[model samples]
Target: MSDYDSGDELLADINAESIVAGTKRDRSESAREVQLSKRPKVEDADFGSTGSNSNDEFVEHIAKTTLKENFGFDQFRHEQFSAIKSILRGENALVVFPTGAGKSLCYQIPAVAFEKIDAAKNGRPHLGSGITIVVSPLIALMKDQVDALLRRGIAAACIDSSKTYEQQQLTTAAIREGRLRLLYCAPERLNNEGFVESMKHVPGGIRLVAVDEAHCISEWGHSFRPDYLKVARFIQEIKAERVICLTATATPRVADDVARAFEIDKSNVFRTSPYRPNLRLLAESVSTKQDKFPKLFKFLREHPGSTLVYVTLQKQAEQLADDLKDEGFHVAAFHAGLKTELKAQIQDDFMASRIPIVVATIAFGMGIDKADIRNILHFDLSGTIEEYSQQIGRAGRDGKPGHCMFYICPEDFYLRENFARGDLPSRQSLRRLLEDLFHRDAVHTPEGDVIKLNQTTLGRTYDIRASPLAILLATLELRFGLIRAITPEYSSYQFEAMYNYYRVVKDDKSQEGKAIFSNAKKAQKWHHIDVNAAARSTGLLRADVIRKLNDYNDRGIILLKASGVENRYKILKELPSTPQEMDAITDKLYAEMETREEDALRRTQEVADLITGDACFALALAQHFGMGLPDGKTKCGHCTHCLTGARVVLPPRPAPSVDMVGIQKILDVCHVRDDPRFLARIAFGIKSPRVFELKLHTKKVLASLEDHDFSSLLREFTKACEAANFGAGTS
Candidate 1:
């Protein structure tokens, strides 16, 4: 008990024992419980709901019984049984079923069955049970599903930003003790080191990982989320036993991307056609944006059913909802920017049939489970075929007729195309990012060369949006293998004792904890510890100090908060050392960005073509997913093209022109973000976060040339910046 005379001596002894030179310490904790063996083959065991049990019969019996007992269903929907069978057999599966096809049940039933089957085999609960980790996209979806599961007496939980630290700790503790059967989280949680470290020590390891909305993993897919790209890597790191990738819509090419990422076999891929016979596709051409209101009103009055009116922007949703409400229509606006409580209330109102029409952006309908939505109206062009399919699939879940109408106009096309073109970062910004990576930013550490990136600051400085910057960083880690991201850490920690401060120091038995607590500087009611200063003073690793403090917080000895988070990356290989080498690397990256930009434009055009083309509407839409008409029929007789027998032409947009006065007004705002790309974004009306923060979007000068080509505006801005000596030597 008495190894040293003083706390300083104790700390020095501990530091010497923990610190290693020129090598990265493994941060993963050792498993406390033994790993369980794989499930016994069903043929070798007598495990079934009834007395008789064959391999297939036993699995089917358990699945059906679990479904009946847990989810209250007597029969399996199309392809659900097959997908669940693959999962029960411990094989990776890719499910490309349409929306409302019970995809959630495919994984949820299996999750519960794992424990039930184990209990059946041993005549008791397994000693070290594994849990299923579900990667979902939305926090609201997570909460909804978790609540539903809990109501069914299933132990399920979610980890998301909305939860308090105390709640997260409770969930984490439940996961470690095998008290939970299913855990839901977003794909970004895989990058969280604290969560990853906790998963490393889970009782029997993660048994199954279900990736919901799995098409987001594919950049080729319409709804490509960059965070989804890291899912396969996360799965490998966790070494989960089985995985099921589920999506409501995926093209053949997108399916391949998902399969390749998860190592799913060709035979394991299951597809139920996304085509719904009950839903009719309709299209109309509008002369102007103002014309959509009367047409929408007329349709809604005729239908008088729950409807979702899709819009392109959040403000448009608000404006439309206001206009409709002023016209004495019961409606609400739903978008991502709304407060959490308000969104929940809106969701409740919509589900309860209090609001019949919701004018919303793309964020409204991911996890809502209402069944009788009768109409889905697109007030603007859908961003892509995949998006249109997924959105419209939300209708007619109860096997009733659902009408889907698309209103197309020339201005909609221009607006969407302008956004697509503005998404790319300029070539100069890419070069600047490379320079910072290889030069002023790199910091040498024991593990490797570390670069601390302030993502917001860097985004503004280079005129790169966060998603694109995330993609660029991910490219460095995944595509090139030149770097790997480490856990981001705060520069400082602020904590206060739950009770007496001295009592905390006395309770912490570890010397590292003692040093950390003793060194915290008291400022008013709270105590602050500069993590870097404490590391140097105590001769402890930064990770070690952070761990102990988090441990203290977990034990309820202190309330903790941390700030100044730095996104750290460790260089895995030598970066380009020469100017020529740097140029070559940057050029390749910029070219890829351009390729992505072109692909976005192509997708936008595909939507335009879908509305105006002479082909049968339903057949062309089905062909996008690589399918044909039902029963070898040449035409879906209900679609607009088949019924009308004529193409609907959209009105043409005006020629591109920019006012010189408006251009100068935009340039005046460029002093805040002096980069030429930033100037061009203002001129073309692209809302980067910094631009939004500056409230530039509210100005009329912004988007002055929104009808003009983005590349042309970029060239114009570059010339203007050089002529005015604006942002000189900044690049």
Candidate 2:
């Protein structure tokens, strides 16, 4: 959610415009420029006919020729050509191609082809030529895509928080000079008015908009994101010529939601068959938790290649990864709970093939285009069939035979059920949140009229996590327009000197500006200055500081850049008055919660049936994705069902025998929470709050069990906690 790009709306250096703009001409002079002509670059590419019309044919020919020339790809598969053809004709398309079926090429080819058009029309690869904007969900994905594009000589750039302020400025400067034919950015950037304005200002114009993982736009999508909902508005704002949305998995309902949100008609929604020839889908039954690990270890040892092991819980991913690593496998865990740097390192390692195995929660696999992955195993149950399909799609992407298997135990469904039902806020939580916001008004923005509230404060007051908070904010934004906008904080500011150092420092004429600008010349080479630090030291309002700098920027006094965390919405309406009005709002909120819970249940049941059913695995899975089985084909020859010639039966798990000594140790040493499970989780290092509500650095505890072996104690404590809360269930 934090990966949005509006932060790059300003210069990187205090005087970066001069530095960057100064160096732009020489690079152009030193490079060999592409030949420009009014005529299209490739006469061979101007095909008069194919499937649609002259332009489609021409784009198709151009795609084939370019594919061969640049990527040595003499062929286009699935709907790749059709997708490219549609984009070239300025048509909106929804492409649901499988993971390795060249889905990216549908947009990538057009971007490259358009680059040639830009080169032909503008004398270089930029200016007057339209830019293709790619809205990707992940920064890593953005970086990978841009890096690949650059390898092929495509003028690609990405803007995200991952880059330094200086680096972001360089990318923007490159875009300004027509160097960026394809600009990749995260979805959150659309919420930034400044970034939107910059896109509108691009001289080459925004010709095409490509959304990867477009399924996120669907309200009921498995991976639905509030930030994604902003993309439709962004596209509308940009007035992009052609919009293409791509995803590997989209159920009919999801596809419909995507179409409506993106305004893509059903006619242009292109779905390649979800069927893959080289992948053999399989499911194995593990009767008990004990049976699962030994079987997995055996599988890994026998068949070794790049593998992805999916687990339901973050703890499972970490524990399994640790276990596998101890067994001499180069494996690491990936989950949302880990710090960002660690996550990045694990992902990078997996991508570089430095780690042959990665045990991950659902967060790791999306947007990964590794071609040689040999296997994907579901160590835990997937929450939905769509997600399950997407996870397995990661394997066998290179058109080589690969294995896709899921280890199923009947008990898994209960955990998934808890997860789905738990995600939405409870009735009490909803009531509390609504009451808090209604009672507390907002502060006026820097503009002094638009009211705003910090989201972090609301989360703290309500005790809601960020994900649920985003969902709540989005719901309010849609129903009542109450949230106004959500954005990052304004962390830093960039400024250029309005007047020369001597004029400002040596004279009384600019004395008023001297406090903020007094040290401007000493830091002239650095593009960014510490806005918060400046405010702390000079007793200036951050808002006032930014406003003054923006004033300087507007009047050519100085160049200013202010980066916001996210853009929240303006509260267009007042809070409901009276108990009855509040009841009405809460009723609506409760209904939404019920709906999500029901949907979650339905999705979980669907996946469970797919896992436990006796039907042909491939047909059942494909049918869910809206693909029709051939009339004579009732079963896929390669699924776990067909290969094993039987339905998998879950082995009944035996409850672990509680270690009374371990439980007593926890009771003895750990601070007891109202809920004993919290104490157990904390002792086990399983992401629980610190004991006694004391700061971690305090090193104070109700009791100490430092002498205990963590592994034995954790195992026993976990089982005891589960036994205590078997009715409540753990996700």
Candidate 2's C-alpha runs over 4 A off are 1-53, 115-127, 326-328, 336-354, 446-448, 491-513, 516-568, 629-632, 651-731
Tens-place lDDT digits, model 1, residues 543-644: 677767766776788888876656778888888879999999898899988888899889988988887899887778788887777897767788788889
Q: Residue 684: error of model 2 in Å?
A: 18
lDDT of each: 0.78, 0.68
- Name the candidate that leads on TM-score: 1
Among residues 3 or more apart in sequence or in different chains, the pairs in candidate 1 whose N, CA or C atoms overlap within 3 Å are none
Question: So what's the TM-score on candidate 2?
Answer: 0.75
For the record, the alpha-carbon RMSD of candidate 1 to the native fold, in angstroms, is 7.3
Q: List all candidate RMSDs to the true structure.
A: 7.3, 9.6
Residue-level lDDT tens digits of model 2 in 1-731: 24334343333123322322433233231131221112233322434343345554555666788888877787988778777776766678999987767778888888778765444334534335657899898777787878988888778888775555446667777765666778887776665555765565554457789999998887678878877887887877655667899998898989998888777878789997777767888878765566788889988998899999999888999899999988898898888888878887887888899999999888788668788899998888888888888888888878898888788875675566545534554455567778866766555655233434556556555444566677777777765766545334565566655565346335534323544665343464434666556665677655445544554555565666555343345556777767888888889877876787688888877876787688888889888888865654888788878777787776554444445665675555554323443443344333212332333223333223322333455456556555656745653
Lowest summed lDDT across 10 adjacent residues in model 2 is found at: 29-38
Task: Identify the candidate with maximal lDDT.
Answer: 1
